[model samples]
Target: MAAFTTGEAVALDLPIARVPTRATAFILDLVVQIGLALVLGLIATLMIALMGADSAWIDVAVTTVIVGTLVGYPVVCETLMRGRTVGKLVLGLRVVRTDGGPIDFRHALTRGLTGAIVDFWMLGGFGAIAVITSMCSPNARRVGDVLAGTVVIYGQKQLPAPALAVPPPWLANWVVQLDLSGIPEDLALAMRQYETRFRTLTPAAQVGLGQSLVITVCTRLGVAPPGNFPAMQIIGAVIAERQRRALTPPYSNPELLGLTPAALAAVRG
Candidate 1:
């Protein structure tokens, strides 16, 4: 799996295209480009024959066709298709930046120029340099991809959603009654982190951290910690209570909502 980490520190698991698949795509693209060149050359020849064009014009047209077929084709396709050429689309592959963002025109241009100069055309037109580079690189990136800051990946896979901790059934009513708004942002963040990863911790570590967090939260809320309640339950309840309060509308009179003045004042204060 190729993990693309964003600036936000979120890691995404995406499949990287292997050498065999990439080579196949490249072969297909090469065949298409060759066909395009043949057609363009034929058209240019016919135009020259009909117009009685000079030798200089013929040389210029041949150079243009060769350069355009080798370099301009990939650049145009990648830019218009947003990193997807015909071959890439056929193989369910896409070129993207290391951060998993879409590649831009400059990236496409660099890749195309580098690929033509060193990877394919320069190395006996056998793509020997590209193959060796991809084999040697950790992520199977060729010289073009390295120079362009891009990578090829299987673009169709979806990332799974993270499972969040929920409040325990026994503490549901108790949590709704408490003034959760008094909890500090840092403490709340700690509770959330603990709740999310408590199951992964060892028994001793879980107990130690959960107890510390429960004590801290209870102190911040100006309430006595319940000894019988599970630590995970307490943490989940606090998280749920905060979310609930955020979604709940404020009442005009606390007494009407069965909340004491002190309870309401705790949140306001």
Candidate 2:
């Protein structure tokens, strides 16, 4: 697992894809690339024969096939599929930026070029450098990942939804009243992740991270953090309020529906 703080100040804990899974994905991709190369090469050869092209043109066609298959496939796939090649999509893996965000075409191009020239083909000794680098790097990043500022992660793990957070009695009223529209989806996701992983954190980590999140949440809401409340409870209250608002009809006010703070807390519980 690797932890990254986003530009929005939200922390993400993403599961890194290790060498075994990556290698499997790579092999699958290699099979595809080879299959594509063979088919395209055959077509090119046929075209050349039909055109009565010279021997020099045959060499050019072969070089074009090799370079296109080796470099173009990954670049185009990752760019179009948002960081996933066909193999990666099948294996639930994705390449993302170091800050745990989706990668762009520039990043894909760099990774694809480095992979062909350095990680696997020209200078890699058939993946020796990639394996060694991944083994040494804590996040299992290869040469291309290091150079492109990207990492492959297990993107599609199915886990049960986290239980809704129950706001403390003292903060329930305040939480429901605050406007939550300002909180972005990414920040909300960060809050949910923090809540779900809260128990696994050490005591010191809990305090520090919880406090930091509380500050971030409060800032987004354009409010002040409560001085005396536990950060965990504050966070829970905010999340609970957000969930509550999601379920409630936009046109109907909870207050008008005769739901008091106590009732809201009970509903969340």
Candidate number achieving the greatest TM-score relative to the actual structure: 2
**Best-fitting candidate, measured by lDDT?**
2
Q: RMSD of each candidate?
A: 15.0, 10.0
The digit string of per-residue lDDT tens for model 1 on 162-257 reads 222367888887777888767865576577677766778999989999998888888888888765888888888877666545434662433212
- The residue-level lDDT of candidate 1 at 160 comes to 29
Model 1 TM:
0.58
For model 2, residues 1-269, the per-residue Cα lDDT tens digits are 88875422345688999999999999999999999999999999999999999999999999899888999999999998878999999999998878665677888999999999999999998999999999999999999999999999997732212245678889988998899888875677677777777888899988998899899999999999977788888988888887666547773344311233454556546
Error of 2 at 58 (Å): 1.2
The lDDT for every candidate, in the order shown, is 0.77, 0.81
CA shift of 230, model 2, Å: 28
Total colliding residue pairs, candidate 2: 0
Poorest lDDT segment (10 consecutive residues) of candidate 1? 251-260
